[model samples]
Target: MDGETALDALQNLTSAAGTNYSIDKNSDLGDMYFNMTNYVGDTLKMMCMMRSHHMLTDVVLQAGSEQFHAHKLVLASASPYFKAMFTGGLKECDMSHVKLQGVCPTTLARILQFMYTGIIRVTEVTVCQLLPAATMFQVPDIINACCVFLERQLDPSNVIGIANFAEQHGCKELHEKANQFIEQHFTQICQEEEFFQLSAMQLVALVKKDALNVQDEQDVYQAVLQWVKYDEENRRPKMEHILQAVRCQYLTPAFLSKQMKSCDLLKKLPQCRKYLAQIFKDMTLHKKPCVKERTPNTPRVIYIAGGYLRYSLDILEAFNADDKTWTQLAKLTVPRSGLGGAFLKGMFYAVGGRNNAPGSSYDSDWVDRYHPVLDQWRPCSPMTTPRNRVGVAVMDGYLYAVGGSSGSDYHSSVERYEPDEDRWTLVRPMQYKRLGVGVAVVNRMLYAMGGYDGINRLNSAESYHPENDEWTPISPMHVARSGAGVATLNNCVYVVGGYDGSKQLNSVECYDTEKDTWEFRAPIRISRSALSLTVLDGKLYAMGGYDGTSFLSIVEVYDPTKDVWEEGEPLTSGRSGHASAVSFHQCVIHCDQHEHSLSTESSLGWCSTRPSSTLSALAGSALNGAVPEPRTSGVGAVSNSLSAPGRGLPDGSGPSLPYGP
Candidate 1:
């Protein structure tokens, strides 16, 4: 043979025999490996050719009016549906022809090609048909491919349709992506015809989500009216039930009044009119709405509200840990200092404190609930007695407002707020009257620490069991403290910086709820009283308060593991007697009000201003599993935007007895 021809023959012979072997160099390990580099590719290519030419074909898949010739072995190997049909004693096991009832012929052909070639083209035009067939045939990879294609094609015009499609086919990832898209673009989506086509249940589901992104609650109210007005004769009955989805309590009294007078449908439906009237009455009476419910992927924020600046200020601000910056939100309903604050359910309640707004100089019995998503404030059923420098804690879904001064006398009385009833009932009183008390709940028991009891700053502590409504004394702290910040962590209640009858104290102590014993921990760097304590990311944060000389803007973080204190980002302004609570809120970071792309991967730290047509590049990057690290500034980043800090709620009240003035 010629030299070139002989070499070619030899190489072909070696490749065909599959004798490519590699040996391990380690003498201790006796191992050898042979790899056929293109074996899988070659086999799949040969099978594809055979199926296309109908050579050695074992089965015919009939979908609609077309037939696809494919090998039983290849089809069964690639699809669980075919595997069960051929091997699970089904009649189709012996049959040469199989009929797929609901699958389309075009979709079947593509699926069969994918079974042999491991490739399928999915696009907007083909995905609608392809996904259902792939789902029926139990082809998860192709189904996922179709879903990914649909997700990219989502927008206000088509998201509702896509969400319905995903829901019907039980595609969970696609459904959630579409639902989140709906939430981010509710105002625009409601204007679309597809939103009008939604059934009552679907409409209610969309409107009631706390994550529904709207600049104002009025948008939701208007949308509901539009939906009902679309087909008044048929939909008017569903109005009362659907109106409940709209947070009418948050709607402006003027807006509600305008709707009641202007809308013909609302007037026609007696039940709808009554519901709106009750909501208006409650709004006027200052009875707040129930606490909001937070969804998954919401951002956790630290809210500091109602502190004394020069006088009692109604300032409300949120600290974003990801950016280490603060954004001023809506002000408190009443300007008050020495307030008690806690997050019950998903709402932040600014409990009893003194309203030091110049002429108004009395302690407040008012309980205002802050809506984190709306950045709005509304009053709830007020406490039985007005209080200042009160202690607050949440236990078993009820908000406890503990002892404080009533502008006349120090009180040991405690009241429990029931959100469902929108009323505060007096619970068991404490053994000692405590003003400026520190309260914490652990192991289903509420613990009240040191405070002033009419005369002296007390060091005594007590625990209350809500089951029997009684208080039992616990071990006392080493130092007498009043206005101390209290927080719970690792089964221990921590008490930080407070006044000890003489001077601002920097001492810190932790009481083990299990052991009922007190032990000292690392003290704060700044000696201050009326500072707010909150736990986040397993660390204790002591926020702004006042020292003996001046109001301090210091923030100290305590680490239990190292037992040390470190300086953190300070507050925007110095304030004392402010209330703080840590909560998971859906934080909307505004960036010039631009739109961005939709990303299905919702994470905690990332912030986007608009849900649609914004962050397009970041969305794709996240889909590819290479999510960029979160930042405070970028193309579409979370900027340090500040709103005005002095907005107050309008005055209105239906009755004065329990709802407060």
Candidate 2:
């Protein structure tokens, strides 16, 4: 009784004293909290001194014949395998030396270094070996670093190898990434050696996945035949199973007969033969064939819309840049010239223009929009003003039909079209009325520059800010221009040749929107009006205009960096007053007067000429010599693309043409 009472009394006294001290006293533990990272880092840095330090090392890691003196605790903490071995009372943990027979000494060193200092250097070449070792050692950080290194180097040739490696190692994330890469590049992977190296079961599993992103059945068939040929005797037995994975129904009869039918692999496969017969039957029955996948993201088809050649016209067509061929599309509702065109949301807005038939000229307010997917034109809301010779521009998701004219009257009234609303709203009028205006967007502001004001061709330039619906007069261009072509590139708005009241001017001017300044750049080689100026691949293209003599079908391209113009691909047929715009490729719409004509084909063709230039490639020919024709430039300077010897039709499926239609 006495002992228990004494212990309770002691405990109660201590508790009361502690409570009083906390309530009655003020204390400062520290003013600022400090990090111990530097101290800890320095201590770890000393531990990583592999060549000099051996004091606390408890074990030797022997990879190959080389040995690394390391601490058990450090290795154990970094790897589950090492942790289990060291802490689970394994017999190897008691040994002074641990031998890793399958590991490379260099990779083991790098892995240990990473475990100690959180740093490792891995490359695509070295990671191939290092990844396996890291996986074996159960070192996740080194494994992750090696995986990342391999992924960055993944390409058509090596992606399959990496994917196979990732799958073998049970790396779920890496396997998923490799699968995606394989899908995106399946066509190219067919050309890789590793693709042919995959086993029959692996190939079947791979190709049979509905997620295979092959452009055509041909690609899959090619891959299968190549794989089978690598060891025909063994793979031949499984040909029927593998051919089932090939979407032979997606292949055309011609492809099946010409490419696949001749192959022994396809001839022997009963499943493939049945699929081909069904495909031919579907073709004969006029059933909708597989919608061939288009080239990804790149618009291989250039849509050609209305323009005047011999009357106000309403013809529409699309030119295939890939195959260098043209196919006519649905016609527009109205025959119009001076087409106000802009591309938005995969549709071409054919805005206001002037109607031309037998003896009459009428201003047209009809807005027919072309939908590529539907291959048809539907009427959108007409502009507030009926204008011909108008300038069309897109800025901030709005279509702007700037200054043009209503019959003989010039217009300064600016109308903005919103696609979502299917309506046009009048914006601030320009400072000067203009017809045949060259309008472009720079820095999200609509710039209306060169145009005629009925009595005088205007050089006065103004900028329209959409945010405030305000028009501010900027510096006037160096020359008065009307019926000129305008384009924007590399942050500058360029105005090319136009009639300057008295003469057809060839002078080119550039306006820097950021600097709010205008400077006369290099003049184009030829003087022409009613031409088109466009930017493709960061370069300016000027084509097809009246040279105060006759209409031109010649095309020219300007190198802004070099301040010079060179000849581009000449249009198959000469045209003027035409409208052209850049898509994934450049397109030109014929717009000549009712009485004049190209005297030949009605279709517009495309070339694969890249518009960008290497300023260092100063060896370009000028083609500045004048031609015999009144409107033709000597060199046929500006147009979209001209990939000589490699020009294909728009379909991209046909054999390449010889630089001509």
Candidate 3:
């Protein structure tokens, strides 16, 4: 007998056991147990070995019994009768202690097999029974296996039962899976009376928690309607609750309105009718509001103005920094009595426009430049072609003028304005002439959205690129409109109210540059066209415009974050075709009505009340400089430092508008 022979014998025994056991020869046990003993030592070893073997066998038998007892203890945790027999054994067990349990014995046997061999075989019938036992024993693997088997067998008809079982056991994953399955198959199961028995509050909870899909939502609505038939008085309160929940969750107004009409709930209850109306109004009025606030950190504001009426200027405003307020800074010097303006670099160049003269040509080649910094107006080189009611916007610092009407005739001529040389260059003309169209810049590209294309109001839109001077067609808008105000915010360009050939439009639509798609947004509070559009602090403000009958002073602010519109302070004057601009410091709004004079009130620039000495010290520390000695006269020293550069505006010319309002 040698070490090799002993090792071979152990391997043979392990193979014969039929258990998946393999001893590693590199293990510590292999090094210690491999050697064999001599003949005399072997005799002594045989006797010792026999005793040791007996002790080891006894220990293993005791361990097996203990394991059985432990298993019984775990089972007894779920039931008491099993505990008494396993813990007290036959010696102490009696009929009185053996209280019959309801759980299947076969299920218990399967659980015991899993505990002993770490293997489980689940059948459809026993899966339900074994799941609870596995959960009680804290056997995660067995519980998972049982759940998988149950899930695979579950269908729409068995969803309720599966949901109940999962809920009772507090199995979150299983519950979610069952809930999703039920939602996906709700149409098949919703015909049952049990679903209708659920309270309206419960139904609402299901919808709000996303436990129902579109089909399931329809089923719930149908079921709730059916419930109302049996007991109107009992179900009215529930219906109201469900309607309120749906409204709060921001469901489509059209769908909610349909539901209300289908159920006749609104007619039955006065309060329900009022609530429904309010929800519809609120949904239609939803808008994104301005979130950016003016602070000491804000820099400068840029203003742009343009117009289409005689002696009027239509303004297209924008901000240069992160601030949300529109500060009137830039202006159009030579106001095109009835023309459009576009911005390039820091200058707003007024495009082709017309002056009032009956029977005279409605076209002028005049252009103006208003310096934002100097707050003064000056003349700029005019356009090559004279036209009015044109679409203008800046792309990559080049001003582009789209289609317009020249001398009572519509022209599709396109021109580009260069600020450096103060000259206009002709570009490729548009395929169709579009007058009073909405123009917007998104990602350095100009979009010529819906407007009147001479013959009829057009729903068509097109994109222009300055790099190649090429025009490409885009998907048309939902409504054929003209005079719409277009502005871009958060990467989406919004086309606000305009006229749809026959009537003024209150419709609002958005175009996503990333998706290259169009969608209807919350319409404006009033139907209008020729309105001024600007984005300040991320919120879009739709200012003065004509609604069909009269000019509007209504100013509605759109909040993108909340997707709601709130009434803002109306402009001092109601005039369409105004100019708007936003900057980090303030918001500047301008209109072309001479009757509505411009306000000289300062827009309240960023003002801090902290002591001048403290501010100076802070500034010094930021620059890593030594603390300067304070002057004896506090008043004079404070005034001098506070009046330094970057402190505030130097001229204090109220806010600047690119053109005279």
Candidate 4:
């Protein structure tokens, strides 16, 4: 008891018999009092039902034509609003019926049901109608519950309505939740008609985030254009304002050539033309489009392992092709020269390189894994044969180490490393004992391409079927390239520049997997052998290699869309004979400098001009294993571009409630 209550009790006892008698302390009295209250609750429930059976109805909540007969005490106890009106000297206390405003009778019935049963079926159809009534009655618990139900129903189709409704009614939690959902799914959500329904200020706020989950400002362009096209007569006045937010410099050239060049909206808005001019000027100066970052998914990363610069070194590095930056990773356990690597299930496996020390079996069979999360390498079982210059590819959940040299011995033997089993088994040997062969995965099969069979540079290529445990011969390339780099893009295997026995080669050939034929495309801008190749951001990359006499730090990118290859930002430190694999991370470091630079103005801002964008979507960026469908006339599927940040939630309410926000 509080001090005031104790003092009052003493005063009351002063006049009682035996004033000095001690008081009895009963901790178990709580359960007794609870039982007594339960009896009172049962009586109250009985009274609440008396009016239902037409026994003694003192109050009626008149909802529409239906009159709900109820006792004043039950109604007052259940709702504070009812308590104020019925017992607080209001005329309604004496009245037979009280009509509720701004809420349907059915909704009121549901509220009453919750008061009695402590549960209500919350549905999308009813939550909207129920929230306002719950708020009016000061039912914060019910308000919080209904808000949660509304949040789970949020999607591209209804989030805008929910956001606006929640804000207007002061449902702060719901408003915050819906707005957060919009930001995380801006790319896909903006494509929805519901997103276009946002007020001018709301849309502006959403489009102006440095960390928007879109690839570039061009996505912002497409989103704004679609919104304008919904109702050009009304939206045209805001065109310049909206388009001004879009950074034209970040748009693909295909969009510039086919769509922006023919835009009627651009001609009408001179300010938008200025935006385009700035992009062109920047490009002329070779300044990359200043986007703060990509958000739709974890950015695809390039992991480089084992290369030769002045000397062979066991160096590990990561190249983010998008931002054109590089990060040095954990070095191999032992220095390995010409070791091959592959990214499998979120880890980098560096295998089969010549040990830094000179000796027999200097071709170390040891295999070590670089866990990106742990930021360190741990040893796994070694290969069946000690070899260097092996080409590693993942197929059917196993890493296939293709042809490479063991000391002076050229190996046609191919082996598969099973991650789950932590074991390596020799697969069917290749048809040819070739050293320095390149391997890539295309169409679910492992293709081992050009290499030296010790006697001569071999143009012959073979495909390994993991299911059958066999190698099937495929058509040969037009030229021989030992120590070549290989990649699969657009359903074809591309063999880049390599040694042709006579000299370093510059010609590039793409093999049609379906046709089983090799066709020449454009040659590399520079002739290099022993380079690393991988596809990133829907473009082919040939990076860091020796071009006959000198080690090259050159970075070349090929756009199959434009049928050309231009220079990209070079690696921070380039070395030849490096093994390259497509790993994944949040963003690529800019290759030119290690600086984390992003443009503020052009990156993200309110759109105040007509945006320039192609009506068609481009092929979505690649994911783990498969290439996406070609981009046609509109934006493609939700690319694996942005990933959300980590946050913790409260217990039992599920992952979404207090966390994963």
All candidates' lDDT scores?
0.76, 0.66, 0.55, 0.67
Comparing candidate 1 with candidate 3, which one achieves the higher TM-score?
A: 1
Question: In terms of TM-score, how similar is model 3 to the real structure?
Answer: 0.42
Better model by lDDT: candidate 1 vs candidate 2: 1
Candidate with best TM-score:
1
Over 1-661, each residue of candidate 1 has an lDDT whose tens digit, in order, gives 5545544564575468764444445456766555656667767876676566677889998987788888999988988999999999999999999888997788888898898888999865677678888888899989899888878777666678888788878899999998888887676779876788888998898888988766457778899989988888899899999998887776656568888888888878888888888887765543435534223344558889988765678888888776687777767766778789998755889998765543235577878887664456776777888878899998756899999876447899999998868988999999999988999976557899998886688999999876578999999999998888899987699999888766788899999876778899988888888889999878999998878667768999999999999999999998888899987544443223441212232333223443333222212211122322322111111112212222211100000111111
- Model 1 global lDDT (CA atoms, 0 to 1): 0.76
lDDT of candidate 2? 0.66
* Model 4 regions lying over 4 Å from their true place: 1-296, 356-361, 585-661
> How do the residues 513-587 of candidate 4 rate in per-residue lDDT, one tens digit apiece?
878899998888998787888888678989877776667789899999887989987876756767787754322
C-alpha RMSD of candidate 4: 21.2
Instruction: Estimate TM-scores for all models.
Output: 0.54, 0.47, 0.42, 0.49
Model 3, span 409-492: residue lDDT tens: 566778877666777899877767876777887655678887666568788888875556678898888888777788888868
Per-residue error (Å), model 3, residue 336: 3.8
Show where candidate 3 strays beyond 4 Å: 1-338, 357-361, 583-661
TM-score leaderboard ranking = 1, 4, 2, 3
